[model samples]
Target: MERSINVLALMKDGERFIFLYDEQSTPQLLQTLGRYAADPEMSFSWYDAAVLSQKVRRLKESQERTTPDVRRSA
Candidate 1:
């Protein structure tokens, strides 16, 4: 299966963060690392992929909650 970059950061708050991008574009981001790494004189390094998938499945039986049936009388 083709893989997409999905970096999730689970924060203290009940919120999920997802960073999706291409591996080839990482060199641009390395500039923020530091001057030593930012200098064009330095070479950039590449890393392998480490991926994880989140799965959701509902197994237990549950009643379907719906709005109460409405009736009108004239």
Candidate 2:
């Protein structure tokens, strides 16, 4: 059975972009990530996918708890 995974970071030049993906479609995700690391024009780094996913989940939960519900009448 297929499972969901997240792509938590993308690096280019001196910048890192943080992203959360509930699922990824590529069959060779790690290989693709490695290619990015090897590319001379780019720089790349990552957190362990499992660890980063967990962190993202916790942050989302915290944000949800702190954020006011807009639908509730004031």
Candidate 3:
């Protein structure tokens, strides 16, 4: 299957942050959010990261639930 880039964007308080990642890169994206939250200079906070992380996980879970499995049952 061809991997496609997924976009998750946030626009708050006149600031916009766009994240581009593939399905396989969700783990990395989660970690990146944490890093952003830890940076004292950045506007991103732990709350933002937590909320976005939930979004990411829910989106992935929904997709997995909808997609059909190719394997046949024994």
Clash counts for all predictions? 0, 0, 0
With a 3 Å backbone cut-off (N, CA, C), the pairs that clash in candidate 3 are: none
- In candidate 2, the residue pairs with backbone N, CA or C atoms under 3 Å apart (3 or more residues apart, or in different chains) clash, namely none
**Residues 1-74, candidate 2, lDDT per residue (tens digit)?**
34455546644566875654443433344445556556666545343444444556675577568767868846
Candidate 2 at 42: error in angstroms?
Answer: 13
At residue 10, candidate 2 shows an lDDT of 44
Alpha carbon lDDT at 55, candidate 3? 93
Q: CA shift at 61, candidate 1, in angstroms?
A: 45
lDDT by residue (tens digit), candidate 1, 1-74: 34345233322245443334444444432333334334565342121011111210011111112323235321
* Candidate 2: C-alpha lDDT: 0.54
Superior by lDDT: candidate 1 or candidate 3: 3
What's the lDDT of the predicted structure labeled candidate 1?
Answer: 0.30
Error of 1 at 10 (Å): 2.7
Error of 1 at 57 (Å): 32
What TM-score do all the candidates reach, one by one?
A: 0.24, 0.39, 0.90
Give RMSD (Å) of candidate 3 vs. truth.
Answer: 1.8
lDDT of 3 by residue, 1-74 (tens): 66778889888889998999989899999999999999999899999999999999999998889867758432
Model 3 stretches astray by more than 4 angstroms: none
Compared with the true structure, model 2 gives a TM-score of 0.39
lDDT by candidate, in order shown: 0.30, 0.54, 0.91
Regions of candidate 2 where Cα sits further than 4 Å from its true position:
1-47
